[model samples]
Target chain A: MDERQLKRLLTEIAHEEIPDDMNVWHEIRQQVETANSRTTRRGFRLVRTGLLAALFVLATAVAYAVYQGLIGSDPGLDAVNQANLVTTIEETQELGGDYDWAVTLHYAYADANRITVGYTVTGAAPARDQLRPFTNTLLRDSTGRQYTWLPVGGGGGGGGGGSSDPDALVPFEDNIGASFDASIIDDAPESLDLTLTIQLAYATEDARQEFGPDVMLPAGDVTFEFTVPFIAGHRYDGPQTASASAIDMTLQDVVVAPSLTRLDLCFAAPPSDNGKPWAAFADVTVDGNVVVEDFQLLSPIVPVADSDCQQYVMPLSLVEYVESGEWTLTIAALRAPDTESPDTVIQRMRDEAGINITPLEDGGYMFSEPLPEDMTAASAALADILSEEQQTLEGPWVFQWRFE
Target chain B: MASLVERYQVHAARVAYLITQDRSQAEDVVQAAFLRAYRSIDGFDPRRPFQPWFMRIVVNQALQTVQRDRRELSLDGDRQAGDPSFMLHDPGPTLESIAEQTELKQQVRQALKALAPEERAAVVMRYYLDFTEREIAAALERPAGTVKWRLHEARKQLRTLLGETEAEEG
Candidate 1:
C-alpha cells in the first residue's frame, strides 16, 4: 500500500496514555521488603550478583537441613530414668502390709514406655513322690513413675507344670517368676536399704531344711529384697540363668522350683571325649522333696514314635535337636485327663530314646515313667547348651500365662 | 489515594519517552505509570534497584492505557469530517499533505491505542525503548522466550495495522 500511510500509523501508535489508579502493588512490595532489609543470613542480592550468589544461598539451605537430619534419633526416648523404675516397684507390694516389699524393674526394649510385672502366690510346692500341682495367683503391674496394675488370677500360662502326688516336687524349670503385678501398700514406709522378709507360713521342717528357712512356715513365701542395685528392666525373659534373684535364704535351704526343662545338648564330640553328659541332671524339688531326682537329657523332643498314644506320651528333648542343629521345639500344656485340676502335662521328648517328663499345671503326673538316677553327666552337657543356646529363651515364653 | 506521586517518576518518564512517539502522551503515560508505581511501592522489593524495576512497571502501565483509548491515540480522527482535503491525498506538495502528515502524527498516537496491551508493550520496549530482551523479561516478570514471542507478535500486528492504513489512503 502507501508507505506514507504506514509511517503515519506507526507515529500515531507511539503516543498512548497510562491511567493513575490501580494500587495493590504497595502491599506486595512490603511483603518482600522486610526480608530484604534485615542483615539476614540470606545475604544481600548483589547488583547483578549473577547466578553464583543464588546458587550459594540454595546450597546453604540444603546444608542446614542435612545437619539437623542426622541429630534427631532419640528425641523423646531419653525421658525414662532409674528413679521412675524404682518408684514403681516400691509402690506395689504386700497389699499394703506394714512390712511390704515393692520391687520395680526398669528395662528398655527400644526405650519404649511402660514395663509390666506379674506376681503369683501358691499353696506350696509338691514333694518329690507326690504330684501336687502348684497353685498360682498371678498379678501384674506396670513400671513407671506411677505404678498401675491388674488383679490376681489363678490359671493361665505360657506353660504349666503338675504332678500325681499331693506333694508335687517343684524344680527350677517349673518355677514361674514374680507376677506382672503386685498388691502393694501405697503408704508403706519405703527402705532405700530395703529388706524383704519372706517366711514359710506352713511348710514342713523337711521342706524348710531342704529349701530354705522361708520354707519353715505353713506355706512358704519367698520375700525377695531386690538388692540396692536391683534394677529390673526389659520384660521377664524366662531363662533360668538370664534372670537372677537374690534371696536372703542363707541359713534356710534355697529351693527354686522353676519348672525348667533342660535341652538335650551334646558336644559334637562324644560324652567320653567331651567328658560330659548330653545334659546336666538337675534336681527337681518341690515344697521340699525332689520330684525328678535327677534326669538326663538324652535328646530334643522330635516326632512321636506312635502318634496314636499322643494323649499320654512324653515329649522329645530339645537338647538332642540342638546338638543335631534341628529338632521340634513345640511345648504344649494339657490339663490332667483324670482330675479337673488346673495342672497340665508338658512333654519335651524326641522320637528317639531320651524323653523329658514334666508337668505343666498344678496336678497329675503319669507314674509309669520312672525317674532317672544321677544324670549329672547330662547336666554338664546342658550347661554348655545353655551357653550356646541361651539366646533362644530370650524370646517368646518358657512360662505359663495366668488365665482367669 | 494520597496523590499517587511516584517515587521513581523520572525513571518512569524516561521509560515512557523511550517507548512512545508523542512527548505529551509520554508525559501523561509516565504520570499514570508513576501513580500505579506509587500505589504498588509496598509490593516492590526494596532490596532491588528501583529504576529498572520501575521502568518495567511504567512500560506496562502505558501500554494498557494506550490500548484502552483508541480515539485519543490516532491521527485522522482529529481532522474534521466531510472536508475533502482532510480525507484525500495530493500526489504533489499541497495543504492536504501537510494536514495529512499532522494527521499521520495523530494516527501514530491512535495506532498505539489500537494495539493489544502486550504487543504495544513489546513494541514500546523492544524498538521504541530499545530495551534488551533480558530487560524486557524482568519488566514483564516473564521468561525471555515469552518476551521475544510477544515482541515478534506485536511487530507483526503493527505491520498489518500500518498496511491497512496505507491501503485506505491509496
Candidate 2:
C-alpha cells in the first residue's frame, strides 16, 4: 500500500528463482566453444583456401552424397508446401558441420519474382507455433546482390505455412517452406544461389509445455547454399470486381508461376476506416474444386498509390486452373481496424471486459476497479477489446475472374 | 567470465523472470545479456559497478521479446517457476502466515501486471532493483523526466488497486 511495502513486494518478486538443474550455463559454454571453433575454421578456410582446395573438394563431394541419402534423394513436393511438382528443382545438400541437427533441402521453386524453398529439419523437437526460429536466409546472384524476404503476414512468416496444432508433428521433425521476394532484382538470371543459415535449439520438455521463448535445448547453427533454377510463367491482369457491404476491391493482376501465385488487389473502402485493408479469402475454387484449403492472411496493410485505400500483393499456394472453367474467390471477411474515439474504445472495453477505464491528466486510461481476482478473466476482458479493434470492418467479399 | 556468470546469473535471471514471467525465457535473456556483455568486456569500465550495466541488457532483451509477442503479464503460479524468497526463507512457517504472504504477493503481482511493459520496467528498476531515476533513465536510454512520469503513473495505479483492497479489508 505504501512506498516501503511496494518496494519490499517488488524486491521479493525480483528475487524469485526456479529450483532445478535446468540452468543453461552448460549450454552457453557449449555455444561459446562452438562459435570460437567456427571462427577459427572460417579463418582457416579464408586464409588457406588454396592449400586445402583439393582436400575440401573431395570432402564436399562425399558429404553431399551422404547427406542426400540421409533425407532422401528425391524430395517430391509432399505435405510440407504444395509447390508445383512440375517445375520444382529437387536439390539436396548436406550442411556438414558441428551442428547437432540435420537439414535437407527437399525442393525449391524460383522465378523472376519470387523463390520458395522447401526443407525438412531433423533434430530436437521444435517450438510449437514457431517457424524458422533464428533462421537467416539470403538469395544472391553472381553480381553479389542479395535479396531480402518480403513480409509474410503470419506469425514468423519465413518458415512458410504449417498447422498451428501443438501436437501436429513430432518435435524432432519440422517441415518448412520459405518464400522470398526477388522483386528487388530487375532481371534475375535463370538461376540464383540461395544461402540459408539457421540457428536452432532443442526445447526441453518443460519449456515445450510452458512455451518459453528463450528456452532452448542447445545451439545448432548450419548454413545450406545451393543453386535454385527458375521457371518462367504466365501473368494474368484483370479488372475483376468483388463487393460486400460497402467494401469493394478489384483484382488488378495475377502472376501465376510454379514457385508462387501472386495476386495484386486494388481495394476501395470508406474514408472513415482505421483498420488495415485486408480481405480474408477463406477459399479459392478453381474448376469447381476449392484450390486454397488453408487459412492464409495478407495483412500489415501495404498501401497502394497515395490513397486511403490500400493494395494487397497476396502470394498464394500453387493451384491448378482451367482456361474455360469458372473460378470463384470466397472471401470470409474484410477486416478494417477500429478508428473510434478513445471514449468509444473505453466503452467497448467496459462492455466486454467489465472493467473501468479512467482517464489520466496525461490523456492515458487506467483500470480503476479492484484487480479481478481471476487474472485470466481480467486479461480475457482486455484481450477481447484488443481483438475487437482489429476486426472493426468485416464482410464476405467474393470476386470471380474468368479465363478464355 | 564463467565466474562472473555464476555470480550474477541468479540476479540477472531473476530480473528477466520478473519482467517476462517465463523461467526459460528469463534464462535465455540472461544468457544473451551475458554474451553481449562478454563480447564487449573490453569496452566496459571496470571502475563502475556491473549490475546496472548487465541488468540494462537483460531488461532490453526481455522488453524486445514482450513487444514482439505482445504477451500479457500473468499472475499464474504455474506459468512461472522459482521463488527467490523460498531460498532465503526457512522451510517451516506458520501455515496461516504462508497463506497470507502468498495472497499479498498475488495481489501485488496482479496490480503490477496492469502496468505497461515500460512502466513495469521503470517500477522494477527503481523500487525492485533500487536504481535511481537518473540511473534508470540512463539504463533505459530515456530522460529522467520520462522515468519519473512512468513511476508516478505506475504508483498511481498501484495505489488505486491497493486502496480498493484496503477498502475491502475495512
Candidate 3:
C-alpha cells in the first residue's frame, strides 16, 4: 500500500515463478544442434533451368543490343554495363537555377526490386567546386522520394580544405560523372516517369578547416523530369514456406539480375501503412562461406493490399550470381546498435575518474575507466565496474533453401 | 552456450515478458536476444558481469518486438487477454490488503507503460533488478546524466499516474 511495499511487490512479481512450459532450452538445443544438420533444405533445385536462362538473356538482349551499339563505348558511361541497360534515355537537360549545371540522363537498369540510374554532371568551375552530391543526394519521382547516389570510381570529391567568403571565386571546369539510385520510385511499370531534383547543401567552415570536409556550400538545384522507358527484368515465382516462433513467412518470388538479387517474401504482421518492418535475414551463408560483408541485408516491407499478409523485399547482397546456388539465411537475430557511443560513455567515465581519454578512428574512444591509478586503491575499485561491455548470442532463426 | 541459456532463460524471459506483456512475443524476444548475444559473444569481455550485459540485450529485443508489433499493442501494455490483478488471490484473511496490493501493482505496470521504452527499461532496471544509477547507465549504454534524467522523468510520470502523491497511496 505504501511506496516501499509497492516496490517489494513489484520486485516479487518481476521475480515471479516462470511457467515450466516456458523453458526454451530444448528449442535452443535443437537450433544449435549442428549448423548444417539442423537445416532441412526446402525446394532443392538448380537455378534458372540452366540453358533456358542464358537463352532468355540473349533473347532479351536482341532489341536493346542495337540501342547499346548506337550509344557506343563512351568511357564515361562505363559505370553501368551495356548489357544490363534496359533503355537508352540519352537526353541532355540543363538546370535553370543560379548556376549552369547540365545533367545528362544516359540509361536506366531496372528490375522488379531496384533501379540504378546513370548520369553525368557538366558544370562551370565554380559550380563544380561548390556542389557535391552524395547518395540520397537527389529526390526523384512525383512524390519527391529521396535517392542516395554513389558515384562511379568513388568520386564525389568536391573536396576543398579552405573556408573562404561565400562570394570567393574558384574557377575550374570539369565533368564530374556519377550514378544515383533511382530505386525510391518503388512500383516500376515498363516505363518510369521520374523527376530528379538536387538541392544545394552547405558544409560548415569549422568542419572544412578541421576535418577536411568533402562538402562545399552554395547554388540552387537542378530539376529534370523525364520518362525513362525500360523493360522489366526477370522474376522467378516459387512458393516456399518457412515457420519459426509461430510466424509463417513465405518466399513468393526471387528476382535475379546484375543490378541486385532480391527475395520477395510475405508474412503476417500488424497492418502498418508507414515504414518498413524490421525483419532481416542474418548470418547469410552462400555455399558455406560468409560473403556480403560490406552490404547489409535490407528488408523493406510494404502492406499487402486488403490482407493481413505484408510483403517484403529482402536484398541478399549487391553481389550478383549467374546461377542460383544453395543459400542459407537466418532471421530472428536482433542486430546490435552502433557501440561506438558506448566507448564515449567509457571515456566520460574515465574523465570522471581523472583518467585521460584518447580518440580513435571509426568512432572509437579509448579509455580504461573504473581502474584506479595506484595498486593499493585499485583492488577496491577493480572489484566494481569491470570496464568491458560486449555480449553475443547462441544463434539465429535460420532458413535454408536452394534455387532450381 | 547451453549452460548460459539454462542459467538466464528464466530471468531473460521474465524481463522480456514484463516489457512486452505478451507471452509469445516475450519468448520470441528472449530467443532472439539469446541468439544475438551468442553470435556476438566473441566481442564480449570475460571480465564484465554477464547479467546486466545480457539484460541490456533482452530489454532492447523486447522494445524492438513491441515496436514491430505496435499495431497490436494496446494503450496499457497489451493487456487484451485479461487483467493480471484478477489472477492475484488473497493468501490470508487480509482480502482488502491483497486487493490494494494488486491494484497498486497494476497501477505500477500501467504507469511504467506510459513512459518511453528507454525510460521504462531504466525504471525496471533500477527497481526490479536493484541496479545502481551508474550500473544502469552502463547497462543501457547511456551517460549517467541520461539515466538520471530518465529515472527522474519516469518517477514524475509514475507519480502523476498514481494520483499525485505518496500520501494518496497511503
| Tens digit of per-residue lDDT, candidate 1, span A1-404 | 13345433433343233222222233323332332232111111011111222223423332111111111111111222222432234322232222121222222111111122223323323434221222222222222222221111111111112333545443211111211211122222222233332232333446656886333222333443332222221111222311112211111111111111222111121222222112222223223332332222112212134321111111111111112221122221111111221121222221222433322222222111122232223223322322232121111111221111
Worst 10 residues of 3 chain A by lDDT: A63-72
User: Candidate 2's residue-wise lDDT over A1-404, tens digit each?
Assistant: 45567777766775555432224566555554444333211121111111123223423332111111111111112312434432344444444333335666666656644666666665423335332222334456556766544333111111122222554432234445555565555563676666665545444446656965334554555666777676554556687777777767676766555444566666666543533234343466776886664233343222345753333334443434735467776666543333335576578767866775543332223343222334334444543454355444455656677654
Q: Is 2 or 3 the stronger prediction by TM-score? A: 2
In model 1, what lDDT does residue A160 have? Answer: 19
Q: Candidate 3 residues A177-275, lDDT tens each? A: 233343344454666667755444333445467656544454555566677554443445667677764557676665544444556566554322322
Which runs of model 2 end up more than 4 angstroms from their true locations?
A: A1-113, A116-149, A153-179, A183-190, A193-226, A231-237, A243-248, A256-261, A267-270, A273-311, A314-326, A331-335, A341-396, A401-404, B1-170
Instruction: Give the count of colliding residue pairs in each prediction.
Output: 131, 8, 19
lDDT of each: 0.32, 0.51, 0.47
In terms of lDDT, which candidate is stronger, 1 or 2?
Answer: 2
Clashing pairs in 2: A15-B84, A16-B84, A17-B82, A17-B84, A18-B82, A125-A171, A202-A217, A275-A337
Worst 10 residues of 1 chain A by lDDT: A248-257
Error of 1 at A235 (Å): 68
Instruction: Tell the DockQ for candidate 1.
Output: 0.02
TM per candidate: 0.23, 0.37, 0.35
What TM-score does each prediction get for chain A alone? 0.17, 0.45, 0.44
lDDT value for candidate 3?
0.47
